[model samples]
Target: MKAVGTSESHADAVAICLTQADYKGHLCEGLYQLKTYVDEVEYGGCDKDAVPTILKESPVCAWVDGNNGLGVIVANFSMNLAIQKAKKCGIGWVVAKRSNNYGIAGMYSLKALDAGFLGLSFSNATPLVAPSRALEGALGANPISVAAPATNEDYFLLDMSTATVAHGKVEILGRKKLPVPTEWANPVTGALTPLGGSDPSSNYKGFGLAMFVEILCGILGDSGYGPYVRRYGDVHQAANIGHCFIAVNPNYFAPGFEERLSDLMNYIRNMQPADPERPVIVPGDFERQHMSTVDHQGGICYAKDLVKICQMLADRLNVTHLSPLI
Candidate 1:
């Protein structure tokens, strides 16, 4: 199939690769993810040669088989399919099995916003989260994202993992030589705390949400569930990850959806802050602000070490090294 968004330009690939590299470094996950993708492509784990197929379809629902293809490409195709179905039936829900990691979940949700529809994206990942009372990791971070368009090209986007904190955050702490918060994880055992930490009352809520995502993405999609899924960077086996995408057109349900959403978001932003210096902000504000800064700078900035890693990746892949734009 054709490239996901626009032209199949080498520039697009370079930008994405560099952006992911920057994200890996900033997120403090090191270059393992970039290496994983490169190794997957080289080993045929992410079968760029294979094509995604629709296993079943209806006016408002569909099931897709990613054939262990690249997650970004497969996810884009799935969301586009949902958008088309929503345009015709007022709503669309699509699920895919045998997929790989699809990077950021918000990217898929924003795709629906771009089409003037509210969108939700969910995916099951390698197990990293333990149940409230459990010590072993039984659930993945299991991220969920939703995006709704508002007036003035604004959007309400919430993308978060069901866990108390993503595994990457722990890695970040480790990289900085900082002590992990007791509520975040058990440093000795390496078991992650749920969204509400070890508290029985709230931790269960996070565990529940994680299970909810697993139900939709894994069980519903007929893919591996919980620990059944392979380790993320294991190239010997297919990831067999699952994803779910949904799109809803506001026109089908209510009028003035965008206006009302914008009004509420603005109200929230204008709310009295307990700390006046740090104003109350709604979800997606930080990301939007960061994007603005990056746009002004013309490109993403990365640490010197990350640049070196990217240069090494370029050498390994025989691609041009990324040059500093700033």
Candidate 2:
């Protein structure tokens, strides 16, 4: 496939360096992720050396073994399979096992959106969430994402974690040396609060949702569940994480799905908000606005510390260092 946007070398360098610096992990562990992909593909992971194997298949559904390969590549393969099936059967469902962290869940779902289909993606993660009434972490901040196309090249994309907040947010706070809100997480204890906080009535909803993801991505996929999954950042053993992808062809059921979707989205945007200062917005408004600003600025704006870290990584890897634009 012809590449668009940033090249892999540039993008992976920035991503690894930033994640290592902000998340405060061993630099080698971060760099090892890229090596892992190459090793799995060229060595022994996939059936055809980096290519996933179909464990079971049907007209509209299939199960794939990632062969302990890189999560991103395996996820792309799974989603493409789902999209191809949906093109023929009007709907397609695919699940994968023995994968690793695949970065943003929305990326996979957006693949379907690019193919002019509704997309849904889900994945189980390393356990970091403390279920309601629990004292320790048991469930992961499993993520769910859905994307649907709209008229005029717009889209409605919702990508979020089941937890009250993603661990990456906490990592960002830590990098800035800021304390988190009590409802967000307990830094000292390392216990993340559920989506609804400590209240049993509402918190159970998040707890339930987390379990729902576990069932779909873990239990259903026959991969590890909850605490059974390897610890985050542990690269020694195979992560064996599970993921689910689904694609639905809106044209199969309705002739004007995009029109109705666009209308509803427009209506929601126009709705009045009780807090006028914080205007009511839809799931994808912030991302669209932010993307527009980035486009106007010419490129991404990285923090000074992140730039320094990337420079150090460049020196260590003997690659071209990144220069600041502003």
Candidate 3:
């Protein structure tokens, strides 16, 4: 656990970590495929020069066609385009297909906000959510993430999966060989409980939100939806999932947006906290805190076991080794 300072600075630390991690074979395969995508699409569009221009361009709307490449690399490039475009226009959006799993949505959203724009990102994944009372899985544990700069406090970040519980969380518990909370997942059937799946019964709303995200990313992006989405570990071929992003400059909406935002933020911070020992914190608070801890420690703590796996992968890839970015 770490406590990071203001959000913008914290984001810079995260960027360093991601870049260092990438250089160490984190997403090397995917990066190569992405470069190829740029080549193939260079001469296919608007300006005969547009394709070539895009290939050399730093920011433009693009479809990764990951070709089963690393989702994290493709996603980073795709969102970079959105942020660059947003700087020029009031808002910019991008949709992706044939992409693999990106580690976290907030990772991408924060990229834009770090550049002074409100950032939004979402992705469709393997179906692991149930709709309504039906037990069959019909949706992905899709996630939506957002980030915005703050004047007097940390950047505002909201990252959440639309499912009762993300599939990753369940997998983590399973990996530890621990019994998942009965409320967290269905024990006998091995299904995720709906959001609020635990106690007071709030899963119906979560189920609805999951469907909403599926429609936006899967349906709108022309990616298949429902149970038709394939699993990552399935023996079958890789799933060609979809993602969507939007970045906006709030100044386009009204004058002094930052000042107004700062005012509202202070009000929220002053509100009574549920626990006296813990102050009321807003979105992005915990992440900011964690980043600070890592900085002081000179890097994040990776479990010894995971470090061995990473080392093995790096050795096999023979990529340039990178030290951890704390």
Candidate 4:
């Protein structure tokens, strides 16, 4: 990140998001995408110096201009602003334009959770998903993330992309030293393309969800909508991606919200499994487990090729290379 002209603080902020994704087992959004960020900067599509300004503001609402800055920085600023407003008004909503690739949406939502409030995050990305029955992509793999606090450090979090799979998985899996899952492979040709042998109903639902987020992040945020956003591989073009953050005080809505949510999650987690081996779990359970595993392991696992790539990047930038701890 320093090699790409980002300040030390800015690079740290970006590292937090990317590392969090890797810690949570979302490999596609982690170090695999760092090269893309570097390219985005070197190609002049993203600005290293970001001066995010509030274009419009009210007690409970705000509009932010990212100044074409780093998406992680822009998202952190916007979400923190929303958290401040929600503290006073019980609810706060913020939207940002001229942002770029914010690797993971869950980080912003978790911010509100840390603040003892519920959080909702939405973002529109590059156009990489074709709508149902369409031949080409018309909408991005727009993602929605929600985080709600429960009792005793438990929580409910839903962070997912609306597309069948993020485009990164199509190529980055090989780089990550992982093989494709056979569940989605074709029985005849043994071919696997989540977007190619896609399920119509799932894509239909995904398309609708993508549009819903696009309206919040793109249309309302006044950034490019659908295909108007830059292509994922086109670093020469500015992404101008948009994002939305909503923070709410759950206590204001009803009493015992956290307690009730805790009860529901616990009961479901303990439910009997039909397979007897695979127990039912809630949305955020796997992430918590992954985080615990990462901590226990004391470091993240990276493919040797990815390590080599990072070393190559460090060499190009005249920086110290990673020590290859893994």
User: Which candidate comes out best when scored by lDDT?
Assistant: 4
Task: Give me the runs in candidate 4 sitting further than 4 Å from their true place.
Answer: 173-199
Residue pairs with colliding backbones in model 2 are none
Backbone clash pairs in model 4 (N, Cα, C under 3 Å; residues 3+ apart or in different chains), count: 0
Full candidate order by lDDT, most accurate first = 4, 1, 2, 3
lDDT, candidates in the order shown: 0.80, 0.75, 0.62, 0.85
**Per-residue alpha-carbon lDDT of candidate 3 for residues 170-274, written as tens digits (9 for 90 to 100):** 765766798888666767666676666743477888777777777767776666576767653452355667777788989889787778777777788899998
lDDT for predicted candidate 4 compared with the true structure:
0.85
Q: Candidate 1 lDDT (Cα, whole model)?
A: 0.80
lDDT of 4 by residue, 190-274 (tens): 2332233455445466667888999999999999888899976888778999999999999788799999999999999899889
Could you estimate the TM-score for every candidate? Answer: 0.89, 0.84, 0.74, 0.92
Give the per-residue lDDT of model 1 (tens digit) for 107-143. 7898899999999999998888888888888888898
In terms of lDDT, the poorest run of 10 residues in model 4 is: 185-194
- Candidate 2 segments whose C-alpha is farther than 4 A from its true place: 1-49
Error of 1 at 24 (Å): 13
Residue 57 lDDT in candidate 2: 86
Task: State the lDDT at 1 in candidate 3.
Answer: 3
